[model samples]
Target: MNVHFKYEKNIQIEHLETLYNDVQWYAYTQDLAVLQTAITQSLDVLTAWDGEELVGLVRVVGDGLTILYIQDILILNAYQNQGIATQLMQQILEKYHHIRQKVLLTEEAADVRHFYEKNGFTSCDQGSLVAFAQVR
Candidate 1:
């Protein structure tokens, strides 16, 4: 199977809508406008494709210097467990490693924690505590 990676300028909003809607851990139902705004504001985004189909994607949101946040790493259900997500992340790290900026986040699952660790992210007990308001 051949995998191609592309840094996209204008992702088909429908593709993102489909991926986000199908992802249980992500909350994309609030409003389409909000989702559109968030996607528009992302600093950089990488998408992986198997021919014409989008198989995986990851986005980086930050100031482009000093700090970066990795978000929305997703691989379609049909394509999971085939190292597609890992490859997507590897490409992100390769592009950003030289900056040596601190990347920070809280993952939703232990399996995801392990995956992040494998990608050189360390668990930090000293990281800030985050609280969120209840979403309706």
Candidate 2:
């Protein structure tokens, strides 16, 4: 399959919602607010398209120069197993290659861990640290 990859910094918010809903791992309907915040404040976002359809996406949110938190690496179910996620991560990594400060929270899924590890991320030592936030 010739999957064409179209890269963009600011993708339509609606397209992102659609892609989020299409992915199996995320709770789409319940995550709209979180997703919106990510889109609106993201330091960078990359969307993958097979022609006019969005197949995969990933975003990084943080201070543009120093710290970056990778958020929402998602690909539609039908598009899984293809190299789309890998390609998306590769592109994001390239964009941040010169920057040394970056981190991402990943689900504990074994495959997901493998993917991140393949991309050069290692498990962090924040074992006793806790993250908290109040949702509006």
Candidate 3:
């Protein structure tokens, strides 16, 4: 798998919907306009592609100096468990290594928890940190 990475803002909307929907993250896939705008407006957007296929992406939003929120990190189902997600995240973390707070919220699946934990992210309960979110 020859994957190319880029920190650019010109990915096609159709590609995003394909990747997002592949993992069942319909909240964003349901609205391409919102998703495209969100991604284009992020502080940083890292994408992974195999030739012409959009296989993975990492989107972040925050002040470059203090806080960084990982809004999304996704890899197509066929690409999961292949270290693509880890590489995407490592790129983002390296770019913002000096930031004090790096955060993200994900579902409570065991694999999700395990993935984040392995990447050095602590759960709110584990780190004594409180996280709050509302589903609209």
Candidate 4:
């Protein structure tokens, strides 16, 4: 498993579809065009590739100065528990260390909470902060 990371946004639709679907994130796979546009327009994108196969991704959206929102971070099911996601998180954090307001929203799950907590993130309720989202 010689996985390497890249900060490239010009990814192919097939690769995006395969990786998103592999992680069971069907919503993004539903619209390949929109997904591609989203990636290209992101503040930053870090992708893990095994040879030519994209196995992991972490993307951010923000002005790159004051706030950063982790729009998505995922790894293929077969590639989980290998620290790829953590590395992705680390790289992004290091890149935006100066940003004061880093945020992300994910489904409520034990593992999800643990992962974010392990990555030095605290839940909204844990602090004096509350988050709201409008999903469709």
Candidate 5:
């Protein structure tokens, strides 16, 4: 696929819109400006591209020491199951391996759970950890 990864904060909004839309992340795509700001303000951002096409992205917000939260990880539908997501996660994981706590919240789909589990993430409720959230 000639894919390459780049750690960039100022990614093109149009490219991100296309990538997010390709993955059905309608809510984010609904506001291009907000999405662009979110990307620019994240603690870290990783993008995967196939030549000129944006195919995957990983967004993280962390203190760089004590905690790291994986805010988003997505791969375009056309590029799913191609190890792109894994590579993106691996890069992020390696970068913050020393962080005391890593966390994320995601939809309760088996595939989603399995994807995180396979990447060495255990569910909070599955263990002694508990999580609470109030989404607006």
Candidate 6:
């Protein structure tokens, strides 16, 4: 796949919906306006495109200096396991290499855990750190 990556925020809503829906992220797809606004307000957004098709995306939200939170990383279902997600993540990490506290929250599946762990992220449980969330 000749995937090209771009540091872009002004993504077409159709493309955003396609990627998010294809990856089964239905919540993000529910409100296109909100999704677009969120993307526009993000600190950084890296998108992977195969020609005109947006197959992957990694978005960060934080103050560029101290706290970098990886808000989203998604790969289209057909494109999973092809290293596109990894490359997107690698690039995001590289871009925010100077930021000391990079964080991500994901569901507790084995594959999900393994993916983050392999990408150099440690579980809060493994360290002295603990994470809490007030998900509505």
lDDT of 5 at 12: 86
Q: What is the C-alpha lDDT of each candidate?
A: 0.76, 0.75, 0.91, 0.96, 0.93, 0.95
Models sorted by TM-score, best on top: 4, 6, 5, 3, 1, 2
- Residues 17-107, candidate 5: write the lDDT tens digits: 8988888889999999999999999999999999988899999997888999999999989999999999999999998899979999999
What TM-score would every model get versus the actual structure? 0.81, 0.78, 0.95, 0.98, 0.97, 0.98
Candidate 6 residue pairs in backbone clash: none
- Residue 22, candidate 5: Cα error in Å is 1.2
What are the runs in model 3 whose C-alpha is more than 4 Å off?
Answer: none
Per-residue lDDT for 30-90 in model 4, tens only? Answer: 9999999999999999999999999999999999999999999999888999999999999
| Model 1, span 76-136: residue lDDT tens | 7878889988998899888887666646566568788889888887766536644443546
Please provide, for model 3 over 1-136, each residue's C-alpha lDDT reduced to its tens digit, 9 standing for 90 to 100: 9999988777899999999999899989777999999998999999999999999999999988999999899999998899999999988999899998899988899999999998889999887789999988
The 10 consecutive residues of candidate 2 with the worst lDDT sum are: 125-134
lDDT of 6 by residue, 2-53 (tens): 9999999999999999999997899999999999999999999999999999
Per model, how many backbone clashes are there? Answer: 0, 0, 0, 0, 0, 0
lDDT of 2: 0.75
Per-residue alpha-carbon lDDT of model 2 for 49-72, expressed as tens digits? Answer: 877777787878877677778877
Name the regions of candidate 2 deviating beyond 4 angstroms: 25-28, 31-34, 125-136
> Model 6 off-target regions past 4 Å?
none
Tell me the lDDT of candidate 5.
Answer: 0.93
Per-residue lDDT of 95 in model 5: 87
Candidate 4 accuracy as lDDT: 0.96
Give the winner by lDDT. Answer: 4
